[model samples]
Target: MAESNKNGATARLRNYFLAGVLITAPISITFWLTWRVITFIDDRITPIIPPQWNPESYLPFGVPGLGLIVALVALTLIGFLAAGYLGRVTMRIGERIVARVPVIRSVYSWTKQVFETVLSQSSAAFREVVLIEYPRPGCWAVGFITGTTVGEVQRLTAATVYNVFVPATPNPTTGFLLFVPKEDVHHLDLTVEEGIKLVISGGIVVPDQANFEGAEVDAAAKAQVAAQSDRAENVEGNGRKRRRRKQTQEPRSPGFITRLRNYFFAGILVTAPIAITVWLAWEFVAFVDGTVTPYIPAPWNPETYLPFSIPGLGVVIVVLGLIMIGFLTAGFVGRSLVSASERLLARMPVIRSLYSAVKQIFETVLKEQSRAFREVILFEYPRKNCWALGFITGPAEGGIQELTPDDTVNVFLPTTPNPTSGFLLFLPRRETQILSMTVEEGIKMVVSGGIVTPPDREVGDAAEPEESTPAPLAKSG
Candidate 1:
């Protein structure tokens, strides 16, 4: 009886320890990560200040977040300068210099455009969350409305289409672009942040159903039923067809070995996504550390003074360097230097052509006025009865529009699973059907291969036809 009591006490103690860990682990980890980021920024930025100007130099101890404040002030000052006429001229001169460098032009142009688009307040990159039926009529998935289809795509179809971005589970960064019909897409009340959380958590962190005010329960039920019936019919038909081919053949049950193998594979499917995500994050940090640490001067390097090596200091230094360069480039003297460098690069023969082509491509894609990949659409490809997903790149340019007597648009039809590689199609305005779903939903469909579907809604008689553009759905603020 004494031994039993002792064992129970030990078990209770173990449980208490586990409970403490459960409660404290998340909070501890969160603060640790935050501290690391703050420390990295502070270490990189603090050294740039002169000893007399530095707060740490006079203070008894170092202060946290001081470097972050300094960085913010520096950026604000740079922006104030860039808003002036001299800053504008300086920026233009610097751009010209970068444009003349063959290899550096491509990198700088793309990087600049990406920053502008992401940072622009007016740009609608991923604002409106939505739902769309993808792969087939019954299946649905969440999407983000990028913008409306424009140029040749709108003219050829004679209808408006929405550009949808469909992000995949686990990794929402990589996904497909789908052009869905405007009336067909069901707008969701959930915010983009909520949608991203749902996707990253693989539906575990679902948004409240009550928030989906526009969702039609009856329509979703009917669509789900229809989908199940269609799947059942297809399975039944396939079974019958297979039976007809061999009269005496009967389906055999799987052996123990086969069952074991299947279970093992199923286990792998459950674990692979999580494993890959963690591994990729670690590799990215390691790569940044490996590449950036070598460039750091020994005297200024954090590792020189510290007993242990810091992984993210190099990344912090790179960020600070970019900010400093932006600050310097906005000034008058920097503009003169940039102009001189540009002239030197322009004198080079073979490098100029390569630089020009790359610079032009970046300008076209990054320009706020450009409508490339802004809208999504659907059209018959190869032949009738077979539909293909595509993004409206822009109006047919060069000799293509002139060569074709009828109005035509350029559509990029991305391949399934991998959206980066796809066919480019030129079709008439009457041939395509524009969709309302966001590009994000379309991407998820392509990545998931029809497994992740959007919510469904009833298409009433009042629904707009393929030829007509539907009215925009009211979006939540």
Candidate 2:
């Protein structure tokens, strides 16, 4: 009896261990991968930054993401400049200089074209999803309709052809581009987003056909498959008969294994964002600690005396130092010293520009927080019917408003993935639509490229129905 009881307990213990692994393994792996990437980037990028300019120079330890921040600011400044007429002319001249190098020019132009096509919002790349027979007649693949075959390729083909991109499993960014006849391409009843998710998941998570009712795309796909199957039968050359294709008729319901795989993926989906966020937060803390710790006298430093070092102790010290400085600056002596120092720096030829620019940026970001980015608005930009998300800086002041046809407001249109650089426009007040969402939410939406959407405000049912809903565009800015 005792032996049986022990066996049961052992079985229960094994199951509990398995359950614990199922819960914690994903979280652990995600954290490990994120740490690896952060350290990797830090190792490479930290050394590139100059010591005088780098925050790490003042600190005892290395700063993660400092190099990245510098690179970001530099790129954003370049982009902001590039939006102007002079910058375009300069860019052209720079391109011409680069074109002089044979190998380098070829690489530059090719890569530039690829980025422009992929990143440009106006391009119709990956807007439509289709299925095409790849590798052989028996095998099939998911592909995106990039566009029509242009110029030489179109002329060579007898029938209308399309540029279909067949992306590899788990990585949709890399793909094979093929020019297939329009009739040969099978249209799937799947949205481009769903198709991408399918490709990224390697066919584990399938979209339900029932959701898209009365869609003729599936019929077209079915006909195309039937024709291909018949063609395969007719093309048999040897005595051995080719097997009829199954799995082509209809997609089967996901079984137990598929469900378990999907659940595993869901765990990853939950863990990944959390892991990345934690890593970034830790990097920031470490960066601040590194920047502040070195300034502390060895006798006063806790880490110097203590057996175990404390993380974020430097952050606390730095915060206290800032408060002290602020308090001192409130007095006459501190103000006089700051002014005198600034005047001296302004007298220097090279240091003046850098000092002024940095000071201006700090003042704009810190002092003018209440005035800047007060409201989120949408206005027509680039062309009519096309709208852009912009933050309302304020009413157009000075000579700028005098020239406009109507009363205007200054709007700061931020660039996506990087919001530091963008176009500033004086838009007519009536043309812009004010949104109820907060500036923080708007910024999040812009930074995430519409992936992070702010929920709509609740409206009364008594109100009249609107004609159409406004959506944030998938543009670069």
Candidate 3:
């Protein structure tokens, strides 16, 4: 009896300890990460201040978050300078000088454009969340409406089309671009941030009930689906068909082994995402630190004087260095030097070709006005029956369009799971089937290998015949 009582107390203690760990671990890690970031920023930025001007120099102890405040102020000052007419003139002259260089021109131009687009508040990069049907009908995906098709693409298509960017799950930076008709896409009520979260979580973090219900396709699409379903039912006698009832498994008390397995799986599901996120962040910081820390002068380096290594000092240095470079490059003297350096690189045979190609691609995509990944599309590929998810890059112009008699569109067919690499198909516009799913949904489907499907709607409800009232005829008589 005493042994049994002792065992029960031990079990209770174990459960309490587990519960405490679950509660405290996340909070502890979060605080630790925040402290590390603050410390890193302080280490790099604090040294820049002269001893007389520094708060730490007079204070009994060092203050946290002072470096972050300093960094913000520095960025604001830079922005204020860039906004002026003199700054604008200086920037243009620098750009012209950089453009004169062959190899460096490519890298600098691309980097500058990317930074500008990202930093620009006016840029509509990923605002409108949309839905698109991907792979085939009955399957849908979420995506973002990037913009409308422009240049050669607009001229070729009879219908007004939109550009959709379908980003892949876990890492949404990569995905397909599809050109879909404006009428076909189902717009979602979810915001851009919410959509990103959904993509990263692999559909586990869905929106609220109200938001989910509000995500409806166009009324015309509903009618069309209903009509199609009606036709299908008519062709294959509805009377002969019966709905298959799904069997529900009976609930039973779990055995010890079963309970243990369930608990283990639950623990994994809870911890894995947090662990992976932290690991990725840590590795990124480490990488930046590794690359930049070695370059720091021994006298200026924090690690040289300190007993322990600082975590994000290199990251802070790298950011400040980039900003300083940008500031310098905006001036006349900096541009001339950069241009001279680039001209020397251009003399290299193999490097020039690679540089030019890369530069062109960056300029095309990163330009604020350029609509590159504009639309999500469906095209029959490999064979007639086999359908694939693709992004409409643009109209097939140049030598390729001249070869084909029909009006052709350039479609990038991204492979399942891994969307980074895919086949580029030049298909006739008439042969392509435009879908209604958004790029976000499309990416989720691709990442999950068709496991994560969009919400189902009843298609044939409107098509069903209603019973006529016989009383109305009698009343008229």
Candidate 4:
């Protein structure tokens, strides 16, 4: 009991620390960045301000923090002005004048496009969350439907669909933009914000499944039938004996030490990759500084001017630095370095084994694989007689397909409550069933482990799934 209390106290302290970070970090960082940007702009534009008439000169306290206030007020006024016709005309005229400047025009135009996209309410830049198969088969991913397909590709394909962006794991801001057929792209019943939460959590923090009324009702109906059947069976005496046998064979939870050890291992799994990457980067930098800096050529030497060290000598150093370490690691020279490093490592057996094992694990996990994009399919998973979540990534490749006779498709039966980890099963298309809910709804059901389902009235309708983009599947379909 005493040990348990000590652990609980430590946990509470950690929780409070995390909570403090969650509440205060954003505001503090936002203010610091805003201050720095304001300072930079003030320094750049300071000379433009007339010396005698400067706002700072006239103020008694030297107009403390004036630049930030000015920037904020100017931005707010510009926003207000842009909302009106006359302001827009004035702004357009100013923009036209600014655009005439050669170097500044490109920067100004790019900034305008970014700002307009972020500020304008009508922009459909990131409107919907979608579940699209990416990277490999047996793995389905969450992506944002940025907008309906446009640009040259759409015109070429004659597609009426949109662009779905599958952001990389742990970083939803960067991912591939796939142009999927409208029919193939399944919209989620999740808000864009909620979908973001799900993706960021990597499927751990899932939306409640109870949100789907239809799925719940269907489950309850099935349960009622199952209960009635069980009652009838129990009356036959065989059921009691079967129950006794099954109860005796039930599995047990892991021992405390086993659970604790697994938890520690999981922590190492998450951090080891990042730690190795940082170590490699540091080693590369140190090696470059040690080996290359001496050969950089003495500043005052006669050959330094290349015909005299050469003009743009600084630029040459920068270029050499960029390529030197990279080239060293790629060819014969790189292999020589690796061999030497290994010899040094071998001198320390314990450290060598630990480093080698960690490096191998990182390499395996980080290596790019071609298996991410597999054939899409529909399947009912996680429950019996009740079809819920599915994945379309179960198709076999050339050699694999030839081995199977039945038209097989790969469907990953994702474990509900956590969709990230699941079983990849080869299922037949004919045996697989279609679902009334959209792809997003299915994911929600899976993430919630069948706790959420479509509303009852719509569940029975195979023809139409009400399409007002479902609330985030993560929130319970």
Q: Provide the overall lDDT of each model, using Cα atoms, as 2-decimal numbers.
A: 0.64, 0.62, 0.62, 0.52
- Decoy 3 TM-score against native: 0.45
What would the per-residue lDDT of candidate 2 be over residues 1-477, giving only the tens digit for each residue? Answer: 999999999999999999999999989989998778777767866788787877788989877666556544554555556556886797688778867976445435433433344444445555667766674554678877665544323444435666566677797765444556665566666778999989999989788965333123455655655565455545642212323233445547789765545444433333334345456557877999898888889999989979997888887998899999999999999999999999999899999999999886577556755456878876554444224468887788789988886988888887654567677889899988787667765665454333233445543222221111111111110
Could you tell me every candidate's TM-score relative to the true structure?
0.46, 0.46, 0.45, 0.35
Error of 1 at 470 (Å): 14
Off by over 4 Å in 4: 1-73, 83-86, 101-111, 210-477
Give me the candidate number with maximum lDDT.
1
Error in Å for residue 476 of model 3: 43
The candidate scoring highest on TM-score is 1
Candidate 2 regions exceeding 4 Å error are 1-256, 368-370, 395-404, 458-477
Under the 3 Å rule for N, CA and C atoms, how many clashes does model 3 have? 28
Runs of candidate 1 exceeding 4 Å displacement: 1-22, 57-60, 103-118, 152-158, 217-473
Tens digits of lDDT, candidate 4, 401-451: 788777877666654334566667766677665443455545543332222
CA lDDT for candidate 2: 0.62
CA shift at 65, candidate 1, in angstroms?
2.5
lDDT tens digits by residue: candidate 1, 1-477: 999999999999999999999999989989999999999989878889889888899999988998887765565555556556886797788768857867445434433433343333444446668777765556667777655543333434425566567777898776665555555556677888998988898989988987665444366654654465456667767886888776556657778765555444433332333344445556777888889998899998879899999977767888898899878889999888878877776888988777778887787777999877776676864333334567887788779988875788888888555777777878776676766545664554444333233322233223211211122335421
